[model samples]
Target: MAKKWFLAANKKQTDGNRMEAPQRINASDGINTSASLETLPHVLFADDDANMREYVSCLLKTQYRVTVVQNGIMALELAKTTRPDLILSDIIMPGMDGIQLLQALRQDPRTHDIPLILLSIRASEASKIDSFDAGADDYLVKPFTPPELLARIKAHITLKRTRNQAYQAIKSSEELLQSVFNGVPSSIAVYKTCYAADNSIDDFEMFLLNDLMCQSLNRPKHDIIGKRYRELFPTASKLDVLDLFKEVVYTGQSTSFERWYETNGKNRCLRFKANKLHDLLIVIADDMTAEKQLQIKNEQMKAKQLEMEARQQREIFRVTLRTQEEERRRISENLHNGLGQMLFSIKLNLDTIDLSDSLFSTEENRKKLKNAELLLANCIRESRRISHELMPSILEDFGLEAAIENICSQLTGPCNFVAEIEPIVPPADQEIQLAVYRIVQELALNIVKHSQATEASIKIYDSNEGFINATVSDNGIGFDIQKEDNNATGLLTIKHRVKMLRGNIHCSSQIGIGTAIKISLPKTIDTY
Candidate 1:
């Protein structure tokens, strides 16, 4: 006779229930189900946006244990300590974004295998390219509906579980079915018969039972030895879930559950997995209740943050434009006060010498007059150069269009310059104008200094965005942008200027390939 064995449940060991069930179901299916299942596997999510975290977390919670954190720092700490089964992180965040965090984790052998995903609204083709370049297992674009997020998570989790092979202690293949069934950490009571294959599990059991299998469930050891699990789960006595567990045993694969339910007046919902052992169904469940709520709040928070960021960017852009305009003003003042007057004085003296020559006679005097004229010519050229350097006079009231033409003329020394622009400023935000000017200036300088190219273009056009955009593309030997820039202020300067304009700066260059500095600045009252 199999000795009837049962042990009382222990809730104190649950650490003051700091991780109590997140869902509360009327425990009145009403039996004292003190037999807690095993602890659930841990998963960590790092996303700056609270709302994204909420959606992903809630979806994942249905099947696996989940933990959603605000940023990479918490994700790292959680991964190091709790050693979650998987880690899902969004790329960009406030303190420490996903890329940096992933690098750190990978460096430490402890958290290397954990998978990282970048979740962001930066879904443009270029942005996607950048995210993958930064070392990510996968990338999730922003505005992803809950179903899409859930599907991606499921694919990754399945991959992770398949990759992870925990050592099993069951005996021979003969007892494989029962042994696998009973080996899980849930209060699963698998019946001896089943007709379904491993892949198709009964829908209801697929959900609840999987949650029960995650490690979060707690149960006494002896109570499971001989007692029928339904005895402990009186309300579930009517549930004939035995067949699903049996299928898992026969298939050597696993069954899953994703759901929300409240029991014992305690809210609990989690992801779970069940595999069969010789005569029992080994059950495991995750605690998802907390993760779901957190994911929701997180997503909401993220939405607000994105809106705030957009506004800030607009403001920064406006400030930068104003700054550039001030710079232009200063340069204009210098040209007028110093260079302009000096050139004018030289012109006047030459004019007087020519007029006086008509009244005087003598070869020596004529030669002297010629010398003065030549000197005046030099002064005029120098003044023009100075004026151009301070501020391109063409760009003053004319805006960015004519200024680019001047830049093209100057670059003619080494490379043939091509310039184009649309002439229009709707009192156009100054930041866009300045950013376009500065960014173009820097790219040209870099080409002259490093690109070793002989040709370039400063093209500008306007679209419905009501914004001025510029691109300085050069046909020069390009260099790797990814190379570490310990002191590369040139690129940084360009980037800063773009940031200030609440604009974007993009550089695409590779060894032997030409480089292009593409910039887009919003023309509105946006801040950085």
Candidate 2:
């Protein structure tokens, strides 16, 4: 397997004259690293030699943005943040060297899969093997011709793109698995777990799924519940998979892999993983058997769908739904589990203390009583905030407009709240209302949190699609939407929920100017 390498790009793609490849010091091919259909191909190049970085940059500039770092420390730092499509590094330098950098990257999930291409003057067979053992995606001999290096790059890049495209095609081919719960048609051993009320994964009721999951392992989920990845999959030899999972969990990045193994004594490869929509792991597997044949019609349909919508919108929708559910669960639990208990205790104390008793009668006792009452009031306010954040209780009592009005008034930012709800939105469905409110809430939070502007506006007007349009705008510094990092998980969640409401969310932002989010959603019947 080629060691994961990464490339850095400033723009989506470069445009210029296609210069011949620069003379190379070293390069190698990768086996386990490449781009996926769901993610764009990114890359990073590192070298202490400014001339070399520039030369390589000039040669690859048309295809990739060449990041020139003074040393490996900078490379590692940039790699964590940029997560380029590929990594091209130099073998020797001050502070951190390529070998050390590669080792660190291997240990970090964010950079592990990036195809790493090493460059240096001391190129030998032994050195090449050492590079491979250390996990270089490709190794090129020093003083090598530009043509040869480019050929190798082309081959490795080509192989990776091919593999990912095949995996995506397979996934699209099997989209009918969209039916939730009855079965995924995919090889998922789901039994039942005590799913959290907020739908976040509190604990997997492994006992129920024990039989199904362990049927593959001959071991139960109990043994694997808190177990490490290496214990679960002896085949996961690369540290990258372990490192990757941690990064995914910590940073909320979605990663996928294709695993090939023998099932039923037959060799098969599975569309192993997909974006983490919620607590559930989305996976797909198909048999490569002669008897288990797929119809030509089905294949045609899969290919067509893959070519068409690809359900990228659905992916976004699922992520948003899962995020909202998770957020609600967290906030509710904080209230119910934390503030709720405290408030209950305070209420009990109040009830137990008789107003007619001596403790309540004295002038000093009265002051003490008044202070206790104030403390209890604060706790009540905290609980109310938590509940409102979760699912404004008022939204149910009154309609969406009144609830939103209350929310706007409570918003602590300096911006004044202004709203226009015609006929007061005519009581849209619960899901639709929640979606709109949540979107508005998140937008408001962003303004309070990031946008350093003074005032903003909110309007809910009817659109031609028989849906309402909610617009939020501010005069804050805007960011490049395309440049938003994959680590911007919050934005992804927002995008997802908008999709769930069968709505369209469009954002227009300009640096030093301002930002605007226009949400157009169809009105659905109430979920509550």
- Tens-digit per-residue lDDT, 422-505, candidate 2: 653454667777878877887887787787877777787776556778888888777788875822636677776676556788
RMSD of 2: 38.4
lDDT of 1 at 141: 75
Report the lDDT of model 2 for residue 456: 75
**Candidate 2 TM-score to native:** 0.37
Candidate 1 lDDT, 1-528, residue by residue in tens:
001100011132245533222232233543212331124445688877665565455556545567899988888888898777667777777788877887888788888777667777677888777767766677887645445666676677667666664323222432574455456554443333223466543222221222233223344434333444444344443544445555676687788875565556566665657776554455555567788889978999999999898887776576557657866896687677766666676565555553345445445457656766675776677677776665666667677776777777777777788988776556456655665776787677667877778888888877556666787888788877887571153675566666755677777886776888788777776533
TM-score of each: 0.34, 0.37
What's the C-alpha lDDT at position 392 in model 2?
80
Runs with alpha carbons beyond 4 Å of true place in candidate 2: 1-298, 301-365, 424-427, 486-489, 525-528
For model 2, state the Cα shift of residue 201 in Å: 71
- How good is model 1 by TM-score? 0.34
